[model samples]
Target: MGIKEFMISFIFTSILLSILFIPTLLTKSFAGIRPSSFSGHPQASPFPVSFAYLISASKGDLESLKRTLCALYHPANYYLLHLDLEASHEERLSLLKFVSAHPIFSQVGNVWIVEKSNLVTYRGPTMLANTLHAMAMLLKTCKWDWFINLSASDYPLVTQDDLIHAFSSLPRDLSFIQHSSHLGWKMNKRAKPIIIDPGLYNLKKSELMWVTKHRTVPTAFKLYTGSAWMVLSRSFAEFCVVGWDNLPRTLLLYYTNFISSPEGYFQTVICNSKDFKNTTVNHDLHYIAWDSPPKQHPISLGLKDYRRLILSFAPFARKFKKDDPVLDKIDREILRRNDGQFTYGGWCSERGESNATCTGFGRHENSGVLRPGAGSRRLKALIVKLLSMRNFKRKQCR
Candidate 1:
């Protein structure tokens, strides 16, 4: 069915859920829904990390956002989904309905929506602002360890259980961001330019305008740049937003006029702080392919890139075309996710016996249940390689 029809159907479904599911959700008695144990499984791991996800989307991306939400959803995780101001109110409502109507999501009550949306300019510092806004909101609402930022074009390469399982054994303070201080050509093209984002004040969409005057690089703190996407630790996010020290606050202001601020803001802040510099893990945790002598954008992943995507051993990949068949294959094979259902995880008990089977939850429903699959092995391999003394220590903000 088309998106409109799907949404209309979902609205009715949500109404029914409010009437039907409220009782099950309110009771303290329904507790046997979680997995019994995680003794020994081929895919099991010992990681106990809880991830907080900030998923950002814009106009014409509702469908992809919904699908990505399901693919990435897990009970142990906290989710904040934002549809930027560019999207229509109807689109935002549809997304809200989908999340609220879902039985498991309503029951768990872990998902959130940013009702007051921010206007984001493409390739502007507003993207960084939006991320920080969500990060701040998440910090206030829940106590989670890692904060993963994703876009509508990105999809999970593994289940949340796998992700949580794999992360359980690792240090809590590590941040997975692809970064380098080399700057190379970007020094002239990005760092030297002073551009003003029209979205900062304009209602209509417009390209960023550059001021004729060039700006000198700040000697106050070293500038580092990297991929906009990252999996950040809660401690580091606190350091950035709360600014117990002045480093994060100072860099935020410095990057206000910086070109491609999303790529530089977090990088510079994390690297400049002596306390956080050593906590960096220099990978974006995504499998993204650039064209030879890459263009402004990474190549949109399609069926042709499937083999490489799986082999990359990364837990996420990006820039996929909407409704790409590769995504369908990922949903079916990798995530074990049906069209509108969450990815298979220990929390989903209803898939086995009854409609409410996976609905089983307890005060500690997320205690020690990780059913990591092949993707976990892949991610684990990459994590292992990254944490190895030589590669891990040598690549930090250098």
Candidate 2:
């Protein structure tokens, strides 16, 4: 071939390659780069306070888990998702992929998956263990004011902005846990029975194994029980995980054979410890609707329960059906999130020419800014009433 012909062919090939690679280059450029906030600033300020969340899910709850994560996600907070060992391999893998692929999660680097899953048994100490496990991981890896344990079946009634804003002025050492020394029927039904959890030693999941012999109630520590869900202050979480004092560890052994240990473990621990007992706020901060008589589980909420749930002024609610219509109402009204997007907050803002919001990195300087809405006011009112002298002192360790 002639030299001229060879040179012309080489130039044309180079042009073709550049054109093909332009899209690829554009996509790669955004990798790990923080997106700009809506104000055209590089990022928005963070909220004054933050929460570290442990979101636990069992088999067949992948969709609900994803929805809950999206709704609760905020750049300032940390999240650890735990899919029970009983969940299918596909479900666990899909959840991991969703967290990894999420553009905002990748950049913020706050979301995590408990790759080493635990076999959890309902109403057993294993449930309590899972909560503690996540707490330990979060304590080791992140710094936050509070640790919130939620299940896939639960949904947020307020946005992260509203939550942070409402909590900003409150005492930092306070723990929002519902507890009472009065055990009622649980004293006989839950405490007396000695049971074993197979999940502790076996690979398979099973119900608690009841023993023929019953044990007397203890004098070492008072037994307290209430809702399993809670918002624990970092100081209290450290006490449970670190156990500088042996109370947390001692009670853990006692509750090992107790029924529904998750409901009592933290409650008993907080109430028994002098350092943290006064910090207890005696509210779980979740709105749960019980049946007329109340059963093993709270009733699954629907559109009909929307008003009551909102008026309750709780930040979170539980036992919702997957993709329930009431959740849609929350997205449209309370959260201002459309279709599976993150709830609106100061750290994230809508960018022009892009449908995505909060898919950006926020500057440290922008931290502590809040864009709280009506939900914030409602939550503030609830907090005020709870912290009132009549309610706060009257409800503690009663």
Best by TM-score: 2
Model 2, position 96, has a per-residue lDDT of 76
What candidate 1 gets wrong by more than 4 Å, as runs, is 1-47, 350-367
TM-score of each: 0.85, 0.86
The C-alpha local distance difference test score for the whole of candidate 2 amounts to 0.80
Q: Write the per-residue lDDT of candidate 1 for residues 1-398, one digit (tens) a residue.
A: 34465345434423422232122222321111222123112123233667889889999999999889888877667788888889997997788777777677666667778877778888877787778777776766666889999999999998887898789889999999989999999999999986666665566668886666677878888989999999999899988867579777666656666788999989999898999999999999999989888778998998898899889988999998899999989987888777777787766643242221223343334445566778888889999999999899999889
lDDT of 2 by residue, 1-398 (tens): 34465345434423422232122222221112223342122124346788989999999999999999999988778788888889999998888778777877766677788877888898877788778777776766667889999999999999898999889898999999999888888878998987777787678997777766678989988889999999999999988877679788777767777899999999999999999888989899999989877789999999999999999999999989999999999988888788867887766663232233554544432545567889999999999999999999899987
- Note each model's CA RMSD in angstroms: 11.5, 17.0
Model 1 lDDT, residue 155, Cα: 94
